[model samples]
Target: MFLVGLTGGIATGKSTVSCMVKDMGVPVVDADLIARQIVEPGRRAWKKIREVFGDEVFLDSGEIDRPKLGAIVFSDIEKRRALNKITHPDIYSEIRGQVFKHFLRGEQFVVLDLPLLYESNRVSSYLYKTIVVSCDDELQLERLLERNQFTEKEAIARIEAQMPLDRKCQLADIIIENSGSIAETRKQVEGIIKLLRSSNHHIYNRVFYGGIFIVVLTAIAMLMYWIFMR
Candidate 1:
C-alpha cells in the first residue's frame, strides 16, 4: 500500500487538506486523534501523565484540562519534553497499528496525518513522501487566532513551538500552498489524489508530482513520437 505522510504546523490547514484527501477516497489515520485517545481517562498514557503532572491538569469532570496543561508545558521546554516522552511513544504505536490495519484491510493508499512529523523524526524513516500544508504566516496566524479565540501573542507562542514553516517546507517532499481560497486548496489536493490512485509510493511517483510540468511535456513528446513512428 502507498503511505503518504501529511503534516504541517499549527493552523496551517493540514486538517483541511486531510478532509479533502478523505473526500478523494484515500484512507487517513490521524495521529492527533490517536494521541488524544491514548491519553483519555483509563488509558495508560493518561495514568502516566496524571501521575507525573498530578490531578491539576484534569477537570472536575475527570477529563484532561488541555488548556491548563498546555499553559504549563508550552511555557517550559523541559516540561514539554517530559510530556512528549510520556505521550509520543504511545501515540506512535497507535498510529502505526492503525496504519497497519488499513494496509491489511487492503487500502490502496493511506495517509498518516501528524502534527510533528519532522519534530518526531519519523518522516524519513516511516514514509517516503511527506505533504506539508503551508500558508503564509499572516494567514496561519489569522486562522489560529480566529479558530481558537487566542490572542495574537498566545497564537504566536503556539505557532513558534512547532518547527518553522520554512524549515518544514524545505524538509517536505511536496507542499500544498494554502494561502489561497479553499477551492484552490481543494483543487491541489484533488490533483494529487487522482495522480496517487494508480501506484505505489516510489521515486517515480515523487518525480511525477514534483516535476509535473516537465512530466507533462515528456508525456506529450512520447505520444507524438509514437504517433510519428506509427
Candidate 2:
C-alpha cells in the first residue's frame, strides 16, 4: 500500500483537496475528524481536557466548546503544548491503526489528511509522498476570517501557530496551488491522483518492511535485556 500525507494551513483548502481525493474512491483518514471524534464528551481525551482546562472549555450540553478551547490554546504556547501532549498520542495511534488496516488489506493507496503534518513531522518512516495545498496569503486570511468569524488577531495567531506555508511548500513532495478556481484546483488534484495511481509502490513496500524489522528487533532487544537483568 502507498500512504500519502496531505496538509495545508488553516482554511487553505486542504479539506477541498481531500474531498476531491475521496471522490476518486481512495480512502482518506482525516486527522482533524479523528481529533474531533477522540474528544467527544465521554472520551478519554475529552475527560482529560476538561480536567485540565476545567469547565470553562465545555458547553452546557457537556461538549467541549471548540472555540473556547481554541482561544485558550492558540494564544498560549504552553497550554497548546499541554493539550498536544494529552491528545497527540491517542490521535496518532488511531491514525496508525487506520493506515495499517488499509496496508494489510493491500490497498493501492491511502491519504492521511492532517492540518499539522509538517508541524508534527509526520512525514518520514512512513508515507510515500506528501502534498501541501496552498493559496495566496491574503486570500487565506480572508477565508479564515470569513469561515470562523475570527478577529484579525485571532486568525493571524492561528495561522502563525503552524509551520509557515512557504517552508511546507519547500519540504513537500508535491504542491497543489489552490489560489484559483475550484475547477482549477480539482483539475490539479485529478492530475496528481492519476500520477499516484501510475506510480510504483516499491518505496512504500520498503518502508513497511523496514518498520516491521525495527519493531521485531526492538522486541528481541527487550527480551534479551530482561533475560540478562533477571
Candidate 3:
C-alpha cells in the first residue's frame, strides 16, 4: 500500500483534511482515535498513566479526565514527555498493525493521520510522502480559541507546545494551505488523490515494504526487551 503521513499544527484544519481523505474512499488510520482508545480506563496505558499521574487525573467514574491531564502536561514540558513515553509505544504499535493489515489486504493507499508527526519523528522515515495541512498562525490561533473555547493565552500555549507550522511546511512533501473555503480545500485534496493515483505504484510498494520490514523487526526487538526487563 502507498503510505502517506498527514500532519499539521493545532487548529490548522488537519482534521478536516483527514476527513476529506477518508471520504475519497481511501482509509485513514487516525492516530488521535487510536490514542483515545489506548487510554481507556482498563487499558495498560491507562494503568501506567494512573501510576505516574496519580488518581487526581481520573474521573469519578474511573475514566481519564483528559482535560485535567492536559492542563498538567501541556503546561510542563517534562510532564508531556513522560506521558508520551508511556503512550507512544502502544500507539505506534497499533498504527503499524493497522497499516500491516491494510497492506496485506492489497489497499491501493492509506493515510496515517498524526497530529505530532514531526515531533515524534520516527514515522517520517517510513512514509512514502508526508502532507502538512497548514494555515497562518494568526488564523490558527483564532480557530483554536474558537474551536476549543480556550482563552488566547491557553491557545498560544498549546500552539507553542508543538513544532512551528513553518518548520512543518518545510518538512512536508505536500503542503495544503487551508486558508480558503471548504470547497477549495476539497479541490486540493482531490488533486492530491489524483496525483497519488497517477504516481508509480512500484516505487511506493518498494518504500512501504522496506519501511514496514524495519518496523516489524524493531517492534519485535522492543517487545523482547520489555519482556526480558520485566
Task: Give the range of the ten consecutive residues with the poorest summed lDDT in model 3.
Answer: 200-209
Which model, 1 or 2, shows the larger TM-score? 2
Where model 1 places Cα greater than 4 Å from the true spot, the runs are 201-230
Question: How far is 65's C-alpha from truth in model 2 (Å)?
Answer: 0.7
How well is each residue in 85-192 modelled by candidate 2, as lDDT tens digits?
A: 889998999999998898777788899998888888855547789999999999999999999999999999999999999999998999999999999999999999
Q: Would you give me the overall lDDT of model 1?
A: 0.86
Error of 2 at 146 (Å): 0.7
Model 3 CA lDDT for position 192: 96
* Residue lDDT tens for model 3, 1-230: 67899999999999999999998998999999999999998999999999999999999999999888998999999999999999999999999999989978878788999999999897888788899999988899989989989878888999999999999999999999998999999999999999987778746576867899899999999999999999
Better of 1 and 2 by lDDT: 2
TM-score of each: 0.85, 0.89, 0.89
For residue 33, what is the lDDT in candidate 1? 84
List candidate 3 stretches off by more than 4 Å: 202-230
Q: Note each model's CA RMSD in angstroms.
A: 12.2, 4.1, 6.7
